[model samples]
Target: MNLFHFSEENGIEVFVPRVKENRKNMPPVVWAIDDVHAFTFYFPRDCPRIVYTRTNEMSDEDHEKFFGLTSSDIIVTVETDWYERIKRTTLYRYKMPSDTFQLFDACAGYYISPQTIIPQEVEPLTDLLNRLMLLNIEVRFTPNLHPLRNAILNSTINDFGMHRFANAKGN
Candidate 1:
């Protein structure tokens, strides 16, 4: 399986294990997302987004509410304010070896490795929205994400990831 670490900065030859300020209690490690969910990182680092997919456990009513009329299996939503920034952003996808990585959060496609990693290659990703469409992901832009976030929190759709939500409008 392919593992990747996405960043806005290029020329990153090595990824050293580092403790994230928000996750200080956890051990230092390099983080990577699996290929299946790499699309979650296809935006600016601080861009707030909500990604989710329908699961068998999700109620039909909840599915209709979030995905009604859409054929996409995956949905990614971002605040409208970040649309221009997302369109202007160019992300680097660093392909990393998975041998030393261990699954940290299966649902979130997060993997961690304590050892420093030298990426196999760095690929530049552009045309963000088109890329998501190519991946069969439905992208939604809303004035505010709070309503969707609250709805998901109360719904039966458990397969969801709200990234950098603290930076979202009105938090």
Candidate 2:
């Protein structure tokens, strides 16, 4: 399905996998977050792909359609670009409130960093033991995340989480 991301500065940027060139190849469901409305994902495949516009720039019908979309609404069709812009090396998830973000970052770093900066470890009784073990092993095969340590202090992405953070190797 088409990935619809809306932002005041960028307007609306749509994205879909180029390989399949079909909505069926896209995720069965998507959670599109924007200030306009909250769509909890699972809309039909034939849902529209309109570029979200500013409150004033949007037409009355378009505004009604967007605002009418409820949290449980599901989207169906998808297409667009920006796969080249997402960070390939490190994946990130963000939640509200800056303090929680900082804490999550620190926890992730302490548990995954090779430097062993943090001496604390999750107890064997907890589920984190296995997850941490897997994560620790995963880190060995993954690129160093140190470069992104200070990333939040200096973001390279737009409000929609995009940008050409790096060039392709063989380009």
Candidate 3:
């Protein structure tokens, strides 16, 4: 394991020179709020709508069929609450107008809120989820091991449990 980790780290270091050269000389637009929160680079708020990617389990075909873009379209530029301490990162994506979908400049959002944040944030999931590390509420992932232990009975919920477990895995 030590040898493997050492080789991996060495390989990453070897790539650092190329990575630095490839990096664009751009100013940092995103601003960090406290230690956990941050905001996007100051750009025209009225510009083209930004795209967001769908969930991991969502296939490329299904995402394009439903939302017209793969999961990579979404960009998460900020997070502002204690949830960061819990390793729960929140992401956001903006959607544009096109066939099948009617809304223009709509915000198609999602969040990785844990059980810890549910009791802390007061607003609805739609409103509170857009911003990260939302101090407005105390939240963390719920500890429900029963469903996880009995995962084989229901595959869909089991998948959800897996996702939730994945989010909390580091802790």
Candidate 4:
């Protein structure tokens, strides 16, 4: 167990790096899972059509398949969101008459809601989860056994007829 946990008066739990592990550079990203099954799913709004990976990685096979680009092509600079979080974070689009998928530009003709994103100053997962309750989003994972889950299931702790248990290899 290399993690240390602390909670403020507001019940927001914070996880910082373990000093002994030499993990000082890890930028914090809040995460929560009531059970292992919990995860997030991204949805595309309105249109029945689904949009997949958008990238400017000219060298990548997937990107090359979708776009007629070669590895030797000159690449452009990339931009990212305020949260500073994105997977494989590289690639900003170049304005082209034939391109219809570069979503953030003026030609897309979409207006965003003022409340589309949560302010960065607010605590992350806790409040967003409360709001998600109204939408009935079910986040779950396959059940697994751990000390905390075991303690929850056997919460009584009466030990009326408790016997020592051993690991699978008969420890």
The 0-to-1 C-alpha lDDT of every candidate, in the order given, reads 0.95, 0.23, 0.24, 0.23
**Candidate 1: minimum summed lDDT over ten consecutive residues — where?**
162-171
What global local distance difference test value does model 1 have?
A: 0.95
Query: Where does candidate 2 have its weakest 10-residue lDDT segment?
Result: 107-116
On TM-score, the leading prediction is 1
> Which residues of candidate 4, in runs, are more than 4 Å off?
1-101, 104-125, 144-171
Model 2 ranges off by over 4 Å = 1-54, 70-171
lDDT of 3 at 166: 27
lDDT of 1 by residue, 1-171 (tens): 999999999999999999998899999999999999999999999999999997889899998998888989899999999999999999999999999999999999999999999999999999999999999999999999999999999999999999999999984
Candidate 4 lDDT (Cα, whole model)? Answer: 0.23
Q: List the candidates' TM-scores in order.
A: 0.97, 0.16, 0.19, 0.15
Residue-level error in angstroms, candidate 3, position 138: 14
TM-score quality measure for candidate 4? 0.15
Model 2, 38-101: lDDT tens digits are 1211112222222111235444554455334433122211122222221121221111111111
Model 1: how large is the Cα RMSD against the reference?
0.9
lDDT for 11 in candidate 1 is: 100
Ranking according to TM-score, highest score first = 1, 3, 2, 4
